[model samples]
Target: MRVSGEKLDDQQIIEKIMRSLSARFDYNVVAIEERNDIFTLTFEGLMSSLCSHEQQMNKRINSTKLEQALQSKASIGGHGG
Candidate 1:
């Protein structure tokens, strides 16, 4: 996402990515490449960190789907499907 209608710099983009990954995660920005307005960030981190992030994301997605399903069910009728 752009800020104030201006494109983010390489460092800004890297910092944003790092924020999502969290500083606690054992990772380092190895390299960055820009092509066709797309910035690619290369990082090296512990396998455990990757796995942990994946698990957390999966849980969030599943929980969101379940919540939506429950809401939809309630809106229609509280009965077994």
Candidate 2:
């Protein structure tokens, strides 16, 4: 099956996607109202985890970019055209 410009294989792919999305949406819609009912929930912890993961990813990406830039600079500076 195909969705817009994307191809979706596997049987019931559309249904599965729709169902999962709908369930997530519904949970989000009701989460705020039922916050008190959800004990042991740590939004702060979740945000901290996400922030740490993002920082590590950014560091890795920047290191790779810096290495590439240095290599390119060396190549260009060492070669006379």
Candidate 3:
């Protein structure tokens, strides 16, 4: 599903994206709140560990996307062409 430039619904999009990511990562991330179309995703655990894990995951995904984009491969949100 793609949401383009239009009058989109924030809460629904937030939930949809959250669910899509959670499934992709195989983790149950609870949406604490959806504020201004941003979902505060969280898990029941230590704050430090959670933050670190999130950062690591984000970093790895970014790196992989960058590499693929550099190699003229597919990516979700890495390029505008």
Candidate 4:
């Protein structure tokens, strides 16, 4: 998914988002690419953060990834891909 930002290329933005999602949810984000400003997520990833939810059984299994896909650049690093 894409967040509102400027200058960052699609790949860079996607990389930052994927890292945050992996960290925040503790999920193993296997792969992340980009298409325009939108993103497609693959499922079956794990997230420890969701364990505390009252409704332990999340109907949407992929929500953890969706939740992790935030709309902000926490940070950017390096010029090399």
Judging by lDDT against the true structure, name the best candidate.
1
Stretches off by above 4 angstroms in model 2 are 1-41
Per-model CA lDDT versus the true structure: 0.56, 0.53, 0.52, 0.40
Clashes of each: 0, 0, 0, 0
Residue 3 error for model 4, in Å?
10
Number of the predicted model whose TM-score against the real structure is largest: 2
Q: Which wins on lDDT, candidate 2 or candidate 3?
A: 2
Clashing pairs in 3: none
Estimate TM-scores for all models.
0.42, 0.48, 0.36, 0.28
Residue 16, model 1: Cα distance from true site in angstroms? 19
Give the Cα-based TM-score of candidate 4 against the true structure: 0.28
Write model 2 residue lDDT over 1-81, tens digit each, in one string.
364766744423423432444342454325433654223334454345445656876799999999999999999999966
For model 3, the stretches where C-alpha displacement exceeds 4 angstroms are 1-45, 73-81
| Residue-by-residue lDDT tens digits, candidate 4, 1-81 | 335545775455545655666353433344223232224322222123234431443535467656555422222223333
lDDT of 1 by residue, 1-81 (tens): 676687976657556665566553433323222232224433333334456666887799999999999999897885665
Candidate 1 whole-model C-alpha lDDT, 0 to 1: 0.56
Off by over 4 Å in 1: 1-45, 78-81
Error of 2 at 30 (Å): 25
Compare candidates 3 and 4 on lDDT and give the better one: 3
For residues 1-81, what per-residue lDDT tens digits would candidate 3 score against the true structure? 345656645555545545665453334243333232233332322234346668988999999998987777545445866
RMSD, every candidate, angstroms:
11.1, 13.3, 14.4, 20.2
